[model samples]
Target: MPVSDLTAALADVRALLLAPDDLVRAVAAGRRRGVEPPAAERVEVRPVALRAGPHLQLVSRTGPVVSTVNAPLGERAAAAVDDLLAQPFGNFHVETSSQVLQLRVTKRGEAQVHRSATSRRAVQAGPQAHDRTKQRLVDPDDPLFRVLGAGGDKRRQVDAFVRQLAPLAPRALDAAAGRELRAVDLGCGNAYLTFAAHRWLAGRAGEDGAALRTVGVDVRPDVVERSERLAGEAGLAGLSFAVGSIVDADPFDGAAPDVVLALHACDTATDDALARAVRWGSPVVLAAPCCHRDVQRQIAGARAGDGLGGGRGGAGEPLVRHPILRERFADVLTDALRALVLQVLGYRVEVVEFVDSRHTPRNALLRAVRTGGPRPEHLAELDALRAQWGVEPVLARRLAPQLDAVRALA
Candidate 1:
């Protein structure tokens, strides 16, 4: 069929589905050959059953004709309609199964095809597509965009990061001491993530009456000043910036923080942020480590001599097999150890990709939400693992006071 014709037909089908009674009346009228029926002779049209498969069948009975119309569309006719709307223009097969309708489109001139699925009653578009299509008022001349936007590439990356973090904001707020929550962002460089987090939390607050206050901390005085100015321009109240290193700044000294965020904190700075979050007993902590200095140093030292003894091997065998490979391996090992430590300390930890690696090589996000007191065995295992590795986890050392020996045993 012609694309225009198909489009019109799909629209008609959608309209028909939306107003079944009107569809029945139209179908009944179409069946009648223009002869006016007597008042008592007017027939009632009632739908018997509508079934969807490779074809759509609408069974209805009227006066003379027990009519059944078949459209070569799946049972999930509404989903088929959605699929048709999503594409620019193409030949597509729509399959319906209970609540889901799958759409597969084949281009006319190309061998390649595209496929997508939608719930029969899904109201919103998928997260990926929704996020991508969302328009942000980020003009090139805009000072805020100039500082925060790292071109289109970095802006997309920032969006993805914000979307990933968006889901955890509510849970974090729920765990806060009160309806009003506070968050601190360590090493908030350009404050892209910082702003995104604030916006997201603000949206959540609007929806649930959970007010949030956010403070962005960076070592660079100029960046902090710029960030504060940007926040003011954006009209985002309860969000501010400060110039300080994570190690020196006590964000929760006077008032406790509900969440702590440190995205792409360099080397030991990520450790410092995590340590501060733990010490403050912040319910939620999200960090993406940019470098692995501690582990790299350990790997370098190991290369000079032998590996640390533990876990199915002795000190003689090389821990990472090769020097270059060991450095890379240490990065993964470092993040893994951080996650394990978080888990041991009674936090539910998730290690997942926060954004595309092309945007930033440090794409991994460590999402740790404090659940309860640490189990006794968890503490013992943490100690044992630290001993086995012969390297202290900086986060573990900093939050030692909060680490309960009895709870670890329990």
Candidate 2:
């Protein structure tokens, strides 16, 4: 992990410009230039082909928002990267058909290379610019897409949402064969993502070029009707929308869903959606929870009550002594409990920021994929935490019936 190795590792990354061997993804970030690029905390580089010729895209990122431009890949791309290394502010992460590297570059002209090489998931390196809201997955010309306009934010969200699904597709597909793969979007709202998922699925080719079945549910009747109209206009045959509550919505409609998704579903609604997904034992679950009021109220109540029952961290004494800190504490505790519950029920769970926090304060995505039973340690931890807190989450109550089976499975 010496910084001296960064120079050679970067040289190897530069070799990606040689073309015939190709590149996958590359990035140079941090404040190496002394002057930071406008709205760009870092820069990303990728080889792309345009009608004119092969080029490298220089994408500048300031938080979640990004601005990119194309330049000839030969000298320009090489020199740009060289300048970055010369001033090297942050880590350099590079992936190519031939190698995968993580170089921690310091301003002192030193680099710590953790992974200098790995031969895995090689790249075809498409010529055109890649988009999160891929036209292939969310057609702009489609009447529905035209009406929606698919702005940069929407496109980015679509891209981010689909990206998370890529790694689990194989397992999900294995569970879904012969029949079309099924997905259900709880709180489908205007169904922007419902359509995104459908278009995404349409582009997903299986060995049989199989079709996909998807449903979107929202409480608002008008939005459901509007989403349905859009689907009709877009000529998407298997996608549909319905009016229902995430709490009571039987989105599966008697069919077992391969994926259950909820984006920014508010408060306990997210818990409800996730609980239902777990009970169904769905292979994949994605939820971006909003409004931590439920847990916040519980925290306030605990402090107002006897000794804060001091959940898992309760023994740490008063973590929530102030209003602002109380709010943040509740948010973390809520998601932690959610993750532990999923782990207890035989699903691998990860809570991650789904987007740049600058885009929205509520940006966490609780993603889970069923991978068999839970570990005993996870169950014991969850049990002890619950006993200490002396309070239950909305999702915990809903999942109570399965608690015994969950522990037994573990």
Candidate 3:
């Protein structure tokens, strides 16, 4: 429990890193004693083969995005492990061929060490960049999949969608800090993600005996009715749906949701969902934008204006010179602005590819958690981007009230 005890536990973890041949995996998760949480919420390291010989691959997840770095086995990898241990992570777990070692950092900064024998095998005899095979989180044969009429490509899609959320959902609930989790899915077409999210989250909540409630909102009455019927057939509790557009949905009935999801909401509909989330002060928000037509139109209209590779042939003009390229450029610019807007409006945001393009071309997901107001640099960058593009994002406009409030304080 003393400082020396914590140091001893860390030494054990570091020693394991040195023995790469026996190391299966190491993970550091949760937050410990700190005024500010670590930059990455979770960090994992595993043994891998590189041309030079054995190496350790470190994968760090800050929010939705993950960054990977490789260090050669031995001192370098041990140093990397030391850096990770320095962070205020509550749990440090190591798995090896012979034993599992877990070092837990209590809230009072006491160190608790637990060791147990394991039948788990060590690193395989070759360079493995990825898992040989992964167990599917959403099995194709799941009854919920059957209830949703998902099979073949549809089932694969549902599985991928849930895979994207797996890493972030638990953290989102943690942000609730043991309170009941209330979620709302905007523009939930047929409520595939709505159903899946609720089921997954409910299971998680059940683990801790925490309550969870989720609702799906869409504009089509028939879709809502079908979703409701499907929910009934699946026999899931605390899930419901409402018929209304993302812009007009009052599905929460004035209660702000803890987690907000807007998956593949078309064009500015994504903006509408985001605007609502910001206004409601939702703790966590995830949106996958589809169709950049709004920004595309703005870019086209501004082509003849200044600073846009105006017909005068500015450097930026070439990117928007071709219609197809312009469309793609708009897609990038649109999401960038949306992310920046959230950053400016007191949310920590990350833009990442939630799923592979093969599953869905519209796979860019914006994952955010409300943190606090924007720093001066973010505001300056937003202004510069708006000035250069000569286009105000629909999200920026829709979020005027909140944005204005933040700017006023700044």
Candidate 4:
């Protein structure tokens, strides 16, 4: 066929796919113009199976003949299909490669996916005054609150941690002090971030200019009592401490917390804090997880040699695994998987280093915001990982029941 004929054929195919009504008219017009409909290639409309898992599938008619198409089914896939169905008439793109006709649905139904208007806005307009003040609160020697401040290297570490979290604080609390904010710091060993959070919230400039509440929680009774005494000595009302593991801290039972802070909640404790915050639907959560031993154990267990073929241990290998390698691998896999789990759970999750290793090697922060419903792919991925590892993660197992609960609330 001539180049012109090829272009016309492509246009007709697109029209047929998009507007079936236009197909007869187009065929009639094509016939009038002496243009023959291209011979149908192998039309195989195999059910669009989701190779990754049962999370998504594409349902559409394929081949040369027209057929009734079913609406996309799975919850997440259906949403994607709905978006495709909402598109106005002329938004799809069709590409032909080899003998395969690839249909890319650009729009569906009544929705038009477009770039966000705010994309052009500057992310950092200026050095926020509130952030500067928050940083000063961690400074051990500031005249306004010298005793409340941190010092030297520790002050720098605290400054870095607070600075990372400042940008994420609820915008409404930006400049306002004492808006009756409630915060719970999990595993608050020395209560560094706990104190900083209280200072920031209580000293925040509210609409009426009032302070808020702050609470620090730890598994150690001594730490809890010490924190309470320190709060009292600082003359900070509404600042208190509680002795409880993050796994059991029920902030939702008493008072809902606006913010939940977890700094270096080792091993599965970070997941505990996250699950707690999700249950309470806390507006903001800042968690810096320390060790990731749960997944590490899973990995080690899965890679172990059994009595099967080639499963025999190599000579001089001590017939056992090295602890250091397992620990390091666990650290990486744990954080990565946790971030993915959070994303799947309908929270916008960001994994970033909260501070330098000099301050703390385990400085990774998983900042997440509750948004849309959970993605099925996330759950599927977690399931697949668990199966592959043949070992369940302590954290994942503990919070498995709550996953659906959190999704429902979202």
Candidate 5:
């Protein structure tokens, strides 16, 4: 950019930051000319309220280590933005209370800017962004993409999976933490998520100078063979698949994984995957469960002597009096206990509606990150629920040996 144009951009940035409640978020990223140290490769600025008053947060990211500083919205905030833009950060995205604006720098050092004043908001809420410019790891035309199929819904599912992995990835990339990430996918029918995850990590590794590898395991020999074939055809050397059950499969012949996944694994298979992930001590674990038949059956087992099975005599009997309500209750109760067990196993767990219900009714996604050993409060909640429910969850029963230690601590 010319010196005159550069001056104008900085002036405009300063005015926005100085304005109250006008600047929603501003990000300056993608280094130009690959500058040297302490000058973070990426920086983000946003408005937030502190104990003192309103402040702007400037977060600078240099590889795995990030430095953040809060400056009141004024000259200091403007300087932070100016410093980054001055270094010629190649990308700019500013979202205001009114509209969103974008600026981009070309390889020829020419600035290409665009601004729209329409009062519109982003479709998705969060830091999850899908870069349209970059070549997707799994292109729609590629053989791998064939597994996810043609629908935009399937594509969105893949994109969402990749985007969600971005925030938690830094822990694995920490300079002191291991830079190599090994991921295993259990019950990977067609290995859709397996390939997406490997590609996602591969992209991150390239940007952060790390390493990544993956394995996809399934019991169906044909699907496993197909996945292996696709990996070979796509030249994905770091990814492989084998015909083995989620409960028995050991990826790469027993290599411990840094992340474990079980997307849409059926019935008790989800439990098996979680138990394996816990055993692996994976830094990140995620699952999109397919069915809750096990819990539903257990809940229905409490039938009266006639065995007509109308929610007989359990603590939450009336809850299952209606068939549809029983199904919904089983899903909630099943996931609740699963989250509780994960918490007891030192993981901070969250249950999310990963995909739209239109895609599938069974859309619950379980995301767990290893934090530390079990917390007393979380375990107490689990115990109370279990005692009241009058039935042991499959996961709780399977993980009893581990849960016992956590209970002792509780």
Candidate 6:
């Protein structure tokens, strides 16, 4: 076991737990690094039926007593697994339909990994897996989906995306009440999620007998044309597509949007979208950022002498030294900065799962709802993080005016 392989092995364990269909059982046992496990450290994972739905039940056993917790099968389950990995657990055993994996951490904190094929029959003989049944938000046969070629796998993703926004729609609509609610979806490549957003909002508006308008913007003219044509054929009103970059798009015709969405916008394009949302003072913003090349490159180019490589002694150097870990950490750092900036601009921000990880790797969503003024503590936190990383997020630059006002308050 070497330092280089440890992170990859841990990442693989994470992937296995995230695979809702394959994960049968997993256990994290033993301890090391001179850190004690919380209460009962020996934890076992199994699929279980919960009142809400199917969940991955985590049972921590110590002698005759056991403490249990349940995490919904998806990104949340992956998060629970992460909490366990952060512990001093020295060994991990995972069983799936196709394989079994065992990872033991050596005294040096290096990982020794072993994996073997497991027959599906033997895997199935164990506890039954969670039921994969999920209620659909949008029917696959709907004219909107059929016309857009969003069926089967694509439809599943659409449903998941729609479900992600389902809870927030009521609140957004309540604020609009008697007025027409407007939404703008930026970087809407094929406009699948854009159309779905429109449908969801429109339906909710219809219940209250209110009006709803949704606009989809993309840089590609061809994709815009196809989306527009599909909307026409589907006879969906108050829904349209426009060709323009997120920064330059005037899809709302100068009117501020009630809801601003940017799903899977690449790199700095997401920053552009967020800047626009802040300038417009959009009440609600949902953005699922795709690539984090901006911050990733900055971290890669940082120097140890400047305290950019995770401080003077390079305490955080190992995380950024590895290409894969650096990329992943950059993603987290970028989103965290985005969330902080949103807070600085007077929005209560939440970074949560945009969709099940199975549908897409870029599942993290920044859901922001405007509350009031920025908190000095949050602004300080933002500054501390940027200073520590020796990186200026493109978003921080993009929203400089708004952030400056927040800073002046301090």
Top candidate, metric TM-score: 3
Candidate 6, residues 192-255, lDDT tens digits: the string is 8898889878876775578898999998999989899999988889998888889887876898
Model 4: CA > 4 A from native: 1-137, 143-150, 171-179, 205-210, 251-253, 305-322, 404-410
Residue-level error in angstroms, candidate 4, position 280: 1.3
For residue 331, what is the lDDT in candidate 2? Answer: 84
Which 10-residue span in candidate 1 carries the lowest summed lDDT? 24-33
Question: 1-410 in candidate 3: lDDT tens per residue?
Answer: 22337777888888886677777777786666555787797788888987788788889987557899898876887788788878877777686766767676655566766576653233342235356333344655679988887767676667666755654554566555557788999999978888988987886666546788899999889998999999999998999989888877776678788889999889999999999998888877889899989989988878877857344387688899899999999999999999898888888787877777877788898888777555445777888888887898998899887777777777
Cα lDDT of model 4 by residue, 255-357, tens digit? 6677788888878888888878776767667888888877765555555643111233533123225777657656766776776677666665667676777
Q: 303, model 2: CA deviation in Å?
A: 0.2
lDDT of each: 0.59, 0.68, 0.78, 0.53, 0.68, 0.78
Relative to the true structure, candidate 3 reaches a TM of: 0.82
Name the runs in model 5 displaced over 4 angstroms: 1-149, 175-179, 303-315
Model 6 has an lDDT value of 0.78
lDDT of 2 by residue, 1-410 (tens): 24466567667656664442356666664433244433344566776777788777778654346788777766776676566555534555565555556565444545556453443332355454354122222333446557556776676666666655544454465567667888899997777777877776655523335678889989999998888887888788889988888777776567778989888888888888999898788998889888889877876666655535654345534677778887887788788888888887888776767667766688788878786765556878777666555557777788887776666665
Poorly placed runs, candidate 3 (over 4 Å)? 1-33, 39-44, 61-68, 74-76, 90-131, 175-178, 307-311
Model 5 Cα displacement at 40 (Å)? 24
Instruction: List the candidate 1 regions with Cα displacement exceeding 4 Å.
Output: 1-147, 303-306, 310-321, 380-384, 404-410
RMSD of each: 18.2, 13.1, 4.7, 18.9, 10.9, 15.8
TM accuracy, model 5: 0.67
All candidates' TM-scores? Answer: 0.63, 0.66, 0.82, 0.58, 0.67, 0.69
How do the candidates rank by TM-score, highest first? Answer: 3, 6, 5, 2, 1, 4
Clashes within 3 Å, all models in order: 7, 3, 1, 22, 0, 0
